[model samples]
Target: MKKTFKIPMSILMVFAIVFSALNLSVFAEEKESNDEYNFELVQKDDNIVIAKATHENGDELYATLDKATSEITLEAVEKPKGLLKFGDDKTTKYIVKAETIDPALDVVDVTIIDETTKSELRISPEYVQAQLPVLVPVVTWGGRALLLWLMEHALAMTIAGITAYVATDLISDIRKSNKNYWPAWIRNNNVYIGGDAFDTDYQAVGWVKTANSGEYNLWARTEAKAKEAANKAAGTNVWHQGKPTDGHYDHYHPAKPLVTDPWVVKLDNHLWY
Candidate 1:
């Protein structure tokens, strides 16, 4: 009985050793596979960030970065084209362009250029935060004051003033009034285009006055009749009130001709205004 137990114990030990050896072999293979390729940033030129990777076969792969989407692409050797391929080594190059980059955010694009077939493998940016709703705060204090002053009797005027004050406060609270005079989205992105991008149905009159001339720059209203009037007067793409610069409002119309002044509008709000 003792001999039988010893024989089984020895067999168990041998099995354990064999399993450990197999695991070590697997780990070594994994390490060797990972060591087959290495990456390095090679150059940054204007809107392009160039990177190079060396494969085990001594073949070099090139990549370009698209800063906007944080995507990398394999660059063609000669032309500014992409999708470059070499031999069967299957090395990939990643390219990142500077234009697509947001420095405030650590956005990066990585691309794998297949050396054998000249194909690309792209990795997109992972958005960490969800987009927040944009709200434009319009203060109606002046209008309320005017309404209060228009009351004839002193008592009546006082009552109206109180009502106005309460109403204004309620409206302001609902609007989540911004003291800085800009929408939260614009503030977050530090964008100041002097334009209106808000849902007009909530307010009768919304305008941003220029500091210099004290004239309305952009205006929108909830009243369908008012919007229709403004749209008609300004054409379908009407400037209810002109921007300080002619092109300031140009970006508001995407379909407008390229020659249109201020041809582009920065889109701070994810929603189309």
Candidate 2:
């Protein structure tokens, strides 16, 4: 009896050790998958260029520009709230700005004003599976055991469980993808110039489209002329007209030209053309 028990016990111990080793291997693989993404701020004349590259372990790398001079300073800034997602991939963001040096020369002062924020997401699925050899075998054995216990009902129960697990995992992945994607919200508004400094006022009208949200938030400037233009463009009869008060312009309307598709309007007295 002692010899018979010893054989089974030894086999079980070996299996347990194998499973634990497999789990540890999977964990190590996950750690080794740290790829560093690269981001850079390039200053060219008056323009600052922002560039990014995908890598495995971006968080461990220092975020700094190679071209750090008195005339130009590159700084990386923390990724903005709502701009970053958790556990997708490593990412770094930098803010590059150019300032005027003097009215004398064409040379402008360029600087990176903030430290880049670095973040790392979850390990890749390939690594997770590659490291865990025992997981699949264990799950398979469990399924087999469950089927054996169920006897006549085994097939149906096993299939249902697998289907449910797969469906749940699919949904979770979809949600995770959605969370990681970021959509840009572009806004353009007409800057109302009052007759004088006291009359100076500003109005903005545009649409906001978020990544997750399907609907757009259409809004027009509240100033009198802006409001009228927006309403006229929208072909809507509803008008909110008010006079200039507290050193601002009167009622405004949204312009139809601005609301049209592929909307292009003058910004800061400068046209794209």
Q: Report how far residue 16 has shifted in candidate 2, in Å.
A: 2.0
lDDT of 2 at 247: 19
Model 1, range 1-273, lDDT digits (tens) per residue? 355435687787777666544423224321212255555657654344555544443445454443233243453222111123223433323232222122223232333334455444332254211211111000011111111222111111111001111121122342343311211112122222221223442231233211111222222222233334233322333223324233222212111223576753322111112
Against the hidden reference, what TM-scores do the models get? 0.22, 0.19
Cα deviation at 82, candidate 1, in Å, is: 32
Task: Go through the candidates in order and give each one's C-alpha lDDT.
Answer: 0.28, 0.24
Clashes of 1: 20
Most accurate candidate by lDDT: 1
